[model samples]
Target: MGCATLTPVPEAWRSVPQAARITDLCARVSCASRGATDVKVTDGKLVASGKDLTPQFRAIQSFDVSLERREVAFAAKRSDNFDIGLVSLDGSDIHWVPEDPADETDVQWAPRGNKISFVVHSRTGDLVRTVHIPTSFQLTADFPYTAVRALGWEPAAERYAVVLTSPEASERIERLKYSGEGRESVVAPAVRLDVAIEPLADALLMRPSTLHYGERLPLIVWITETPFEWNDARGALMRNARVACAIVRQPSEAFWTAARAVAWIDLEKVYVVSGAPAPSPAYPGAPLSATSVVADPKIPTGRYRVDDRIVRAPPAIVESVAAGWIAEQLKDRNGPR
Candidate 1:
């Protein structure tokens, strides 16, 4: 007897089949850069300047930057619960760059471009990873702990700078290098700068204000929450509410200020920090003051606003591929009827 006649598979059955495979969907989608990486930081206080900061950025988030004025890279959140994105643009609009399967957060684009580094919040603290653009490849940057004070890269030096936190101890900045096939990371070990911002570390967050890669060795400016010390019996338990900025050069160069935000007015002869309270730092003659024409954006920013619940358009081939897969599966199930 011949096999029974095969009718169109019901929607339920169609849901399970395989369609034509899409080797690479990234090649199909295209968009221009809207300077997703154009984050402006001037010498000023690190306080919010009433800019209706995005909710996602209210907490810990990545700083945005264009590899240059022409190239920009950023991370847009795809879901409310997890951050799963890294995208780029060349002055037009942003195109999605792929992410590692592991859940990642605290994303930052490398100053050199075509690469981004992020932390994977895992059971064992935070694991750092670097995503290579256009290829969607991931390189693990092994960090000992999950708490990151600041993260940035100086491609010219062939190293990355990271500020790590030790809640029970001091906070330090360390440089790392990547080697091996997967670019496994190795810490410089001895190269580190240790600074303490106790109460601030507890109440607020930390992130690289920006890292300057220019003719001289790269310098990193990091924004830390209000500066706090031991609150010795001689003074109040907490310092007045204000932001702290740290400018560091690998060989133990660190500067501090009680500015509301910072703007790189000159960065060499004179650095600016605005909204100063009688030239703060409270050290009588500390070098923090409201001195600059540029206003700091408070928090680093990107060109586009990311919708927490991204209503994104999936790849066009996705449906076709799924449909094709389902049809093939249906064909196999029903045989040659």
Candidate 2:
């Protein structure tokens, strides 16, 4: 079947640069710049950029920049604590939450944009606590854990997904659910790992791979066991596995392929990255020239270069593409039928 066509953004809106900072909500062009332990947002009109509140932190783990709101939310790692903060566009109002560091893996804003969720590591680092944003921005409530590695809100804003490491097996996938709700249903499951050995005392391997939102889903690259040769084997046996995508309204079951890389754009569409030359019929004729390519809204063209060796694309680029598509879809849905 032909791919779904996404509505194009109006020229006025399309001309505006993608928002990179919280303040971008108000300004036209906003960008984020991270320094030695600090993150800042600069806008078209602003002379000075907004800086991180806790500059002494070892590192800023992750943050979301809002150009439309002129705000930034980020997490910092200190010697003893994980500090989460939200700063306004002008960098005047700073809200913070500092928690004891047990095993905090990640932090993110909730769908409503009023709260945040974070993962806290147990003292032993074996267990994790998915915590809700506390009343003081300093308090925390334990969230359910199925070995969360990464967290994100769904497009519909009603649910979220936690990319997780399975406790029962040596595998990684995503767990999806609604916030303040119970256990997460499995969104994507682990891809199987295949291994092969050669006479060079090394190994070659391939496995199923899944990328989170904006990541081209259904990636087509294999994991190399030795990190060197194509067919060397040095590790475990190979297994047959499937990679899947689980969006709120759309879910896809895809088999892993050695020549093709795929990423989830949403429920109905996917972004593909291929390393080798593209095949005819089942596959597109040539490798996507852009760094990554999405197959939603009828295969739009892009400007980035696709790297054949590495299966991953730049995160910012992926985010920009996804956001643009979402914005277009939102506009379409709101327009006259």
lDDT of 1 at 200: 22
Each candidate: what lDDT?
0.34, 0.35
* Model 1 regions lying over 4 Å from their true place: 1-60, 67-71, 84-103, 155-157, 179-337
Q: Give the TM-score of candidate 1.
A: 0.34
**Total clashing residue pairs per candidate?**
31, 37
Model 1 over residues 93-212: C-alpha lDDT tens digits? 335545445456666666555666777664333566776766878767664323554555654524565555432223344556532123322232222223232222113222223334
Indicate which candidate wins on lDDT. 2
TM-score of each: 0.34, 0.36
